[model samples]
Target: MLLIGGSVLVGVFTFIYARLVCTFICSLPPAVLARTVGVLTLFHIVLRELLLRFSPLQGERSTPARRAWLLSVVSWSLTGLLAIVIHVTRYPAFPAPSHLKFAVGYWALGGGLLAQVEYLLFERALPPTPTLSPEAQLRERLGRRLIEGYVIFTSVPVLVLMLTLQRFIYELHGDLRYLLEAVVLAAGFTGGALAVAIAYGRSLRRDSEQLLEAVRRVGGGDFQPGAVTSRPDELSLVAAGINEMAGGLQLRERIREAFGRFVSPQVATEFIEKYARHGKTAVLGGSRRNVVVLFSDLRDFTRLSESLEPEVLIEVLNGYFQEMVGAIQRHGGLVDKFIGDAVLAVFGLTEGQGDPAIAAVSASLEMRRRLEAYNARLAERGLHLNSGIGIHAGEAVAGYLGSTDRLEFTVIGHTVNVASRIEGQAREPRPPLLFSEEVARRLGDAFTVKEVDTVALKGVAGEMRLLTVEGEARSVRAA
Candidate 1:
């Protein structure tokens, strides 16, 4: 469409230019039908050659080379009309003496203008640079083509122009042909340089467009990487960069989905975001804030796992954790990590920093709610896995402390250890919910909690009091 539009604009100028040149050079008689017919026939032949360029049959065989050869033929054939065309007084008959001279010059001007147009069009069709190979090379051939056409046109015309200049102006006046040669040489150089510049620009545009399209296609989910060789110039670099980015995205997506398998959907999101924000996969050996911890285990998973095949065990485990994790995350918790048969989760942690204590309690209740639903579904499938949870709130440091090469983002220190011990000590007789004195103090009286006991857990300075939340787990404590 652009090329066509450009051509239409060019035609408008060509018409105006042709009219001006015709007015001065060719004031032919109205009786001259033959001269008009001859000019029309020549143009029709040029148009025929132009149309042949689009033929699919000629594409694979040899169109460019043939086109070049045909161009040479057109120029030589016109050269043959030099003498006869000059003397054609009118079309069929000789009229006034002055009319013949005007007609010849006018016809030559028209032919020169037409040839220049064809030369430009043909040059535009070729590749811009010498280094280009077929369609793969992205050099704007137009400038190079124009340079080549000008070169071809200039080589023959320079000799003629020089001879004319010498004979009519310089030679007759006892002057030098060197002046005429110099002028001709300068014009040739200028035309060739223009051709080169146009071709170069055209090449750049073509290459850049193709590269941009490739990148956009990949962004649009084409996903078919590894076939990028068309990237010419900076485009190649861009494609390479995009391929690297896609690789990273694919890796993140893999990790994102994996979290769901080992943990619940809720936990997975927080865990993923937390790890990504801090630039670590998991953490260990640190302190955490006042938090609630949940541990879920299969009551008879050992026996069941022993009986089941490897695939069956994994399938059951994955299904079980997916439900549990989803439940925990819905209440705003993060999955710390998953051991072989147990899952560890931290609630009221990073995601709930402003009010970690309250958020932990909410998450625990939601976890229980999700577990109830999971048990019902498991009942239908004839599978059973049970879980125990422990909640405690206290000051602790959470950070990235893992292997140098492969890091894990996690929370450690006193709160994590205490939360774990509370889980191990939990019993059906005592209470399913346990919180530290610290957690109780932070929570105040929002929840109706009881001081369960003060038991000396391993590696602690003194026995820590544990509380159990009974009812009304409201967010804010009453005065």
Candidate 2:
């Protein structure tokens, strides 16, 4: 709108001045008006050419303020010269019968043009933007987007007003036309600059808000990937930062899930992230606690398998083990992997909990329940189901291991061996589950346990005191 208005004003004045030159001012002037117009045109073009060819816009060092100031000064100088040439050519008529007065007018107009450069000088005028602490500064820098709205907005209008005034003055003498052009150019440039600044500020503020939101989500551990898309150039840096943060969290999650299967969730979390480092490797071992250990073994497995096809026997064993593991996991127990048809589990090794003895007893009860359900279906086929479980409560060494070549996540100690020995003792008429006196002592106060005399375990020297928990009168406890 400003450009079109300025152009119309320039056009109207041009037509009027052309009429005056043809009929009244310089009569039959052939090259006079044309020459003046050509000179003025060459002058403004030269001003524009300075920016295009000589302006040192190299690399990231192209300071916009410096460019604007230099361009403004050159533009004002060219326009001032154009005005003076027209003034001296039409002397006596412009300054109203005085030479000194015309000189004063020319000097004032030139000074006014020079003053317009002040608008572009902003480093000394505006306040600095907000900054972050050293730790957060890297993240903030990654999210900023540099916009070009300022350059396009200011340059478009400044160029428009300058071009319009030059056109109007080309045809006319130094009069109201020159003053009107100055007003239009100054107002247009100033307004354009403010509008551009406001737009840039709004866009920057909005981008800043979004980046902050992304940072907050990362801190909160909400590591859903692909939260933000690319925005090209400077903005792409912000998206990269978000994805990088999300990736860190995703790695943590993978480690957690993998370790959780080996230990417990709480222990898994501490293992991957909280362990202290000396050089670079994690030095802190896994958290330790008194826990319930249970071991089970398939009785008559070799003979039972000898009667059936390998495929059917293997399938049956897999199905039975699957059911048993599910029962253990559902009751807050970790399956310490499978050793053929033998199953091993721990109750409180990785967790800070109640009592290991009670957990073992409760697990034994549930295991028997699951076994009966299984045997009921197989009873018709005479595929007798026989298994024994042993429970023990004691210390265990639970941590990541496996020389340096392979990493194995596990829990191992004397308690695991003791539990296996007890399981072996629960053969034939002796019952399906056996527990050590130490494990029974750790059970909840309500359990009715029968004391069984000490029996020598296979590896350990001392005979182990044992007990048998009959049923649900025992409240399960996990350490």
The digit string of per-residue lDDT tens for model 2 on 1-479 reads 32123223332343344434322334526465455545544554466456636765322332344344445446545554555567467754543222222122122222232223232332244222343233233322222212233443455456445544554454455466676768776777677776666676556555555666677777787776344533454655886778787887778688779877665565566556555212245543454656788898889988998898999888788778867877776667777767878998888754554455665577677777788898887777778778999988888887766654455556788888888889988886677788988776666464777765578999988888877865443434321
- The TM-score leader among the candidates is 2
Stretches of candidate 1 exceeding 4 Å from the true structure: 1-196, 209-292, 298-314, 347-354, 381-384, 397-410, 444-465, 470-479
Listed in order, each prediction's TM-score against the native is 0.48, 0.55
Give me the displacement of residue 42 in model 1, in angstroms: 59
lDDT scores of the candidates, listed in order? 0.57, 0.60
Error of 1 at 258 (Å): 5.9
Model 1 score (lDDT):
0.57
How far out, in Å, is residue 96 in model 1?
A: 39
The residue-by-residue lDDT of candidate 1 on 1-479, one tens digit each, is 33333323333333343334333324544335345435544543554446555533233333353355355345434533432364453343543332333222223333333445554455567523443344432222332444445554544455435434543453246456666566777687866766665666566555555555656666786544543544355657776777787676667667878966654455466667777747874654555465566665555668888888899889878877777667666656787788887777776655534466666666666656677777787787687666666777665666556685665556676777878787666666666667677777876655677888889988778888888777543422321
